[model samples]
Target: MQQLRTPHVVVVMGVAGTGKTTIGPLLAARLGVPYAEGDDFHPQANIDKMSAGVPLDDADRWPWLDAIGAWAHGRAGLGGVVSSSALKRSYRDRLRAAAPGVVFVHLTGDRALIEDRMSHRQGHFMPTALLDSQFATLQPLQPDEAGVAVDVTGSPEEITARAVQALDALSRPAK
Candidate 1:
């Protein structure tokens, strides 16, 4: 398999319950590139708000998203993977602006399955109760946006395989 970072950038995105955390690292490993968890860039305040079951406003997310985008942009020549919940078109637009060649992988799954995963997950700032708000705000990637949308109902390995295959197909040659 080709290395993940061989391309400019890859952003693994979806709602809270998707397998971004697992898939991002696997993709990174497959591609021999570094992996960054976008949530790690969020300010403490954002984490506190999400943990409190309050959804973040755009103001709350802009800086965080920008930080992640900048990181990806910085590594554009080397390539990397970022795991993020970029639910809005504007947020994605901002990322596209920051990292020109960044390709997005959108993971989607049944709401019930997502909720179950969120409920069972631990140590995440986003609470299960806030999932509805996230889904409500989500705007799937437009046709013009460079991305691949995939189902998240399968096993992590299977999901990773699918994601890797799609990314390999969609990825442009590294600059």
Candidate 2:
């Protein structure tokens, strides 16, 4: 039971099929915190657009990002975990503006691996066709950002374990 940025929320981020949904709950459960699925926050319009193989523009995303940010704001101080395909610096910034001190765990994998997973996925609105747009738009976590990048080359459990360990280590007091 380590305090991972006590009073902060963990945003598990990455492109489609990168395991944000899969790993986010594991993170929340491991931390004994509440879990939020990012997809659940999407507006119907957004879903319809992606389902049609259309990529969402920034304009389309702002309101959605803000909504998720609002959720993060609500969870602030209580410490929680949520998943979002927070692909750009601006998106991450927006969430941070809402919930100060929010940290990120960015799951990453190569396009081939991600595509394979995306193809095998069932009932998800996001089409594999838009994965290129996701990758094109992704801006990896930068230095000075309160976050960590995790490679998704392992099983979900391994990824979750790594995320929990990394986050817990981060929140520990400096020697």
Candidate 3:
């Protein structure tokens, strides 16, 4: 395996149930780096609001996003992987601005599969009822964004492999 550089930041982003938590740690291990669960950065109020089945407005999300961005920025070359429900293009932009050259791995799956996963999962603040609003807020990442899109429908091992492969490719020396 090619030795991976500390990427500054790696954003494992997607809507709910996209396996950011499941896959991010393995990716971090593969890269020989630290990882952060982006959910940990959310304020208690945001969690309470989501648990109550209320969707947050952009005003509600901006600060939380900024906080996660700040955490990513703090690591610099030490590198870190962060799992987040970065459901909008603007959110990704803000995060990228906070830490330049941040690589985003977007985990995506069909609505039915995602909804089923969300419905069955436990202990998360995000309720199944609020999924539609999240989808509504999501803007697909542009080509210019330094990122990769992975389907979350497969096994955790498979997802981790794909993510590592993508990161490896990005870290490769061009011939």
Please state the error at residue 133 of candidate 2 in Å: 0.7
lDDT on C-alpha atoms for all candidate structures: 0.87, 0.90, 0.83
Residue range 1-175, candidate 1, lDDT tens digits: 2223356688999999898998999989987889999989999999998888899999999999999999988989888999988999899999989988788899999999999998898887788888889899999988778888888877898998898888777665655
TM-scores, each model vs. reference: 0.93, 0.95, 0.91
lDDT of 3 at 40: 87
* Stretches > 4 Å off in candidate 1: 1-6, 172-175
Candidate closer to the true structure by lDDT (higher is better), 1 or 3 = 1
Candidate 3 C-alpha RMSD relative to the actual structure: 2.9
Q: What is the lDDT of candidate 1?
A: 0.87
Candidate 2 lDDT over 108-157, as tens digits, reads 89999999999999999999999999999999988778888788998999
By summed lDDT, the worst window of 10 consecutive residues in model 1 runs over 1-10
Error of 3 at 56 (Å): 1.2
Sorted on TM-score, best first, the list reads: 2, 1, 3
How many clashes does each candidate structure show, in the order listed? 2, 0, 0
Candidate 3 runs further than 4 Å off: 1-6, 173-175
